[model samples]
Target: MKFQQVYFVVDDSFRLLWIGGEWDESALANGGSDARSNEVLSTSLLSHITDEPTRRATQAMAEAVQDTQTALRIDYRCDSPTLKRRYLMTIQPMKDNRVLFVHDLRDAQTFPVTFSQWRHQPGADALKCSFCCSVSLPDTDWTPPEVLAGPHPDVVDFTLCPDCEARITEAVSALRDGRKPGVSTTSGYGPEGTAS
Candidate 1:
């Protein structure tokens, strides 16, 4: 599907000078519109981005706004309800004023989520079980049903949300502070008089 685009000028001081695709009819008349094709762009339109690299580029821009030797490129998204917007920002030296190339990211690879949404998300390649490499979750009720019944902290006694993580960090910290494990008074026995 074809994607729409817009551009915003960033000045030497990192100020928003002018926006190219501000729902202006002039841009549409000038053939700068991405709506040439009748493709239906959904409300969940994507953003063209990579997080870490963009951060570094912005930092470089902050420090080297005056140096011709340094150049910065930032590809960011615009939060517009009317349409999806992605911009490729180029910060470089010009003879008179600092120039920012605001190219439309229509054909660029897109992510359905924005950068903020992606960062906030837990991630797909995360630790499947918080128990770590050595630990495991038992399905037995004696161990508590919360861990087995659903995704909740009640699985662990005292309701530790991330019992595995807590244990790992606590173990390391305890070793550093030279401490011993505490005893538990609660019995592990079942209704049939299993081991307590």
Candidate 2:
């Protein structure tokens, strides 16, 4: 599956100078025609980012670009109602301006499913089960990594989620007790193996 990307040019002050790319225009349009026009006309880069932490991070990157006049890249996630997406944003400083490239990384059907199949793609993050190498879905359930294995496995990284971590702990306990491993605590039993 193909991912969307957007590009923009901004001055040192972070004001939009030029905006191009299919995704860029589409994103602006998604905000409504008035907002899109305003963005193209005079909006600041940080204005588009609703999340405070992401805005701060982007602000820092802009400041760093102004100081060093060097190119840099960062990753951030955007959780909009229409788009729960991750992006890799690259900033390249020109003589008096900077160019930003935003690459989208949200292809669920084709995402890498296994750790071996996974590659460190620069933008998105995922929750993984440390013991089983299964990934957590947005619904807070886990699935084997191989279920999402895309053509580029090496681009994504995974972290352990709480439910899977608990499952792993229970499995280890069952092994130590020489008993057949059972379902998770959430479903199987209470503290002393009483029905939950």
Candidate 3:
């Protein structure tokens, strides 16, 4: 049940006080040549997040955690030239006016109950991806909905994110054109399914 994860302690002002977990120094570096852990210390945790919408959401969550003195969870996506991934972040308020942040990377698709559907469903608390086990976002192109909209969770509609939808479209087009659908060599889905 081990997944790619990272954790850090942040002051009420969102300053990163400490960081540790499964993430390596390279993964923790914020696009800097100096990937040393010491360099990451004292930096604002939100500074490492490049997405505007996600960063704003994270800020709101941090504020709420501090105000209510309770824990909160949020799902977000991050992508850079070196990495593209989704994570679930949990924020817990500490007695010392600091917040503990836990980040769990989504690596595998979990079935049975999709995270998106569970949120709107009654009595469910766990959030997870519906199909690909990747984190789910509403408006983002990289991570799209896998289920169709419906009142019944059992009959939920499944939809792929824009990137995945595009990959499927390209593969289908290749088949229609009577050629083999290319396989991507890199981690991302490239044009015509070939490596970028």
lDDT of each: 0.32, 0.45, 0.47
User: Which ten residues in a row are the worst by lDDT in model 2?
Assistant: 187-196
lDDT string, candidate 2, 1-196, tens digits: 4466667777777788876665333332112233453445457876765334335545665665556655554333322222333444455677655656444443213332222333222234554332233455455456544345332233333343455345544444443455554333322113342222
TM-score, ranked from best to worst: 3, 2, 1
Model 3 has an lDDT value of 0.47
Which digits, one per residue and each the tens of the lDDT, describe model 3 over residues 47-148? 765334335545665666676676665443432222344555567889778989887665334433333222222223222222122333334223323342
Report backbone clashes per prediction: 1, 15, 12
Best model number under TM-score: 3
RMSD of each: 20.9, 17.8, 18.6
Candidate with the greatest lDDT versus the true structure: 3
Question: lDDT tens digits, residues 1-196, model 1?
Answer: 3455555444555444445543332121111234322231221111111232223334344335345434344333332212233333344555445444444433223334322211112222222221111112343232322222433221221111244335434433443344542211112211231111
Positional deviation of residue 51's Cα in model 2 after best superposition, in angstroms: 2.9
TM-score of 3: 0.47
**Sequence-dependent TM-score of model 1:** 0.30
lDDT for 44 in candidate 1 is: 11
Q: How far is 139's C-alpha from truth in model 2 (Å)?
A: 18
